[model samples]
Target: MTSKNEITVTGGRLYYEVRGDGPLLLAMGSPMGADAFAPLADALADRFTVVTHDPRGISRSALDDPREDSTPRLRAEDVVAILDDLGAETADVFGSSGGAMTTLALAARHPGRIRTVVAHEPPTLNLLPDAVDRHAEVDEIVKTFETDGLEAAWRMFLSTSGYQEDEAGPPPSDSPEQDLEDGRRFFVHELRETTRYIPDLDALRDGPFRVVVGLGADSGGLLTRRTCAALADELGVPVVEFPGDHGGFIWDPEGFAKLLGDILMTENVRIPLARV
Candidate 1:
């Protein structure tokens, strides 16, 4: 069974859901929100103590410090605060896209807090020499959000992310306009603060922690996959292949969950089984 609750943090109240009954697993979603992780959380709940929460300014989470600024490192600190609040000594963290970037930052900054990290396709453009143009592209995206409006900005972001129209359909628009407004506000802060998130490679390498760089089998040839490959190489580790693409947890929730569970178990995760 999954139970939803809220936790107070530096910013405001952070809504989170806890489920399953095993080793603690912290699933961090993209910068979008924790709702994006629902499917994955449900799937993993059977064998793991799954915990998913809304990041600082997104969803049910409120902003406390107007000056928080939402930088990657600070964002990481928020996650650490969550761990501290929960009284968990360590956890297994899984993050994708922006969340993946945040995971890397967290692992690098709070090495002792996490036992293992599985980051799937972190969009770390700075790591790619050829991706220098992405800075300008993202800058234009931010500008579009400010001027042309949310629809245009969303479309442009998808295009830049290589999701061509007619192929990936429209951006999941339950309320396109409203979504854009919220996204724009949050991303404006995230982009400004996130770009400065440079991982401390030396610290990551020397940190006594196990880091898993995972990529989707279907996400091959994508920039995210490439980034994962590079990160694995830098860390002197192999990039493990997950069940599906960037949104695998949503696309194939059960399969993705099983893959995640297997990986965590292999990485020395111990979940106390309930005995009859």
Candidate 2:
């Protein structure tokens, strides 16, 4: 169901996997490794040459120099490096969570290298005119990861994210220590630099690449979904609605893959596909 490979990039080596063999769709998972996308990858592989990889510092990707940590621009460049190493001049891309933020950067900074981009729920708090304070709050949470640990940071995060103060309960894995470490070591570096992130929409429009803003049908009014709607309105296109929530690709990978299969295939459909 999966095929694995490796590619060398600046400052590190990437562990990658290929699933299908069509129009080269590159998928980046949330902070978790590409393995999180296993379900979607299998579903799409038959129709497209699907590619997924661990980001620079996670999983099998080796960072030769620990001092190589950096900004989102550097992470976006890693995506570009992966494509180049695979001999792909350009490809369609789908990025979620922090990965979605990375996708926007790629489109804005390297427009000529992407055919199309779908950025789902990028969590661009800096984009919302009313959400600037929320950005600062999350930044503090990132700081907590440095001072406190993952559990405290996550508790604060879930509480702020409408997790309903123990109403929804803790993650099944519930390893606060592990979470704290991951946040301090990996997320703090990636997310803190990403907080005030806002993409140049003007540049996105002028670029040749087609853009689709995704909102999870189940996510409702979450900041990321609203942000997607705002962007779709600005771009003069219908919001591309998909199944599931912020982490839909992981929660409902089978259904998510089916939805994605349609999105990637029905680009030319007459009726704007609507999800109820």
Q: What is candidate 2's lDDT per residue for 1-276, written digit by digit as tens?
A: 568888787787878888877888999854666777777788778788888988777656767875455455777898888888789899999988777778888999999889888877777776667776887787788777768876677777766665556634224335655444445545466666664677788877888888877778777746676667666666666777677777778778777777676677777754233332
Model 2 weakest lDDT span, ten residues long: 167-176
Scored by lDDT, model 2 comes in at 0.73
Clashes of each: 1, 6
After superposing candidate 2, which stretches have Cα over 4 Å from the reference? 67-70, 166-181, 270-276
Error of 1 at 105 (Å): 1.4
Candidate 1 matches the true fold with a TM-score of 0.89
- Residues 74-152, candidate 1, lDDT per residue (tens digit)? 6677788778877898999998877887888898888888878888777777776766687788888889888987667
Query: Model 2, residue 239: displacement in angstroms?
Result: 2.0
For each candidate, give its TM-score against the true structure: 0.89, 0.87
lDDT of 1 at 193: 56
For residue 263, give model 1's deviation from the true position in Å: 0.8
